[model samples]
Target: MTAATQPLLPEGFRELEPYVVDWALPTRQERYDMRLSKDMTELGVFYDAIAPRAEAAIAHLDTLDLDALPEPELRLLRLLFSMILVSYAVNVFEQPSIPDAGAAFFDTLVEPAV
Candidate 1:
């Protein structure tokens, strides 16, 4: 199966995956647009729904050596981390700027070779 179509983690992270039913990442413009609803209630609901999968992803991530993953898997891992950071910023910290939070989160990650 192609990387996008492949099951990265069976029975986990299905809801938060890109193109999934619950996937939502605000664009840089959206972050600055406070006129839009940045309600945590909806984000909380989605986070609660995906908590199990997020935990599972955390557990699975612990098992892998990041530097050893292939290019495609590394990209997938980045996606997972991006989702987690966005959720943390919006839900936990109630941060209004997704782009800033994303930049902060990724800034700390050690880049592995593609």
Candidate 2:
């Protein structure tokens, strides 16, 4: 595919996009389970597989000038950040009594003014 039609995320990372469909306005569980889910080994595999892709993707991202990225690429970057941030949250916060609190906080900060 030409660059215009190519997937915005770095190759393997594109598969992770669906989980972040509403990253801008995700429910608590959506945010909380962004990594592994105890009942879904497939998701667990996906979570496990993403680390290398994330490292490569972030390396690619660092090479770009954010202000100059095409709109689609920028949106893809936002999704990439969401994945990284959710992983970080789980590590730092563990399972919280309020699963969605972080999602709500992020929606306020990141969601467009629509």
Q: Judging by lDDT against the true structure, name the best candidate.
A: 2
Residue pairs in clash, model 2 = 28-100
Q: How far does residue 14 in candidate 1 sit from its true spot (Å)?
A: 3.3
lDDT agreement of model 1 with the native: 0.48
lDDT of 1 by residue, 7-104 (tens): 54334444444433224323323222421254666555544555556566657766778668644344445545445645765655675355344445
**Once model 2 is optimally superposed onto the true structure by TM-score, how far is the C-alpha of residue 113 displaced, in angstroms?**
16
Q: Give the CA lDDT, 0 to 100, for residue 35 in model 1.
A: 15
Stretches of candidate 2 exceeding 4 Å from the true structure: 1-12, 24-49, 96-114
Which runs of model 1 end up more than 4 angstroms from their true locations?
A: 2-4, 8-11, 19-42, 70-76, 91-95, 98-114
Number of backbone-clashing residue pairs for each candidate, in the order shown? 0, 1
- TM for every model, in the order presented, reads 0.41, 0.47
Cα lDDT, all candidates: 0.48, 0.50
Instruction: Using TM-score, give the best candidate's number.
Output: 2
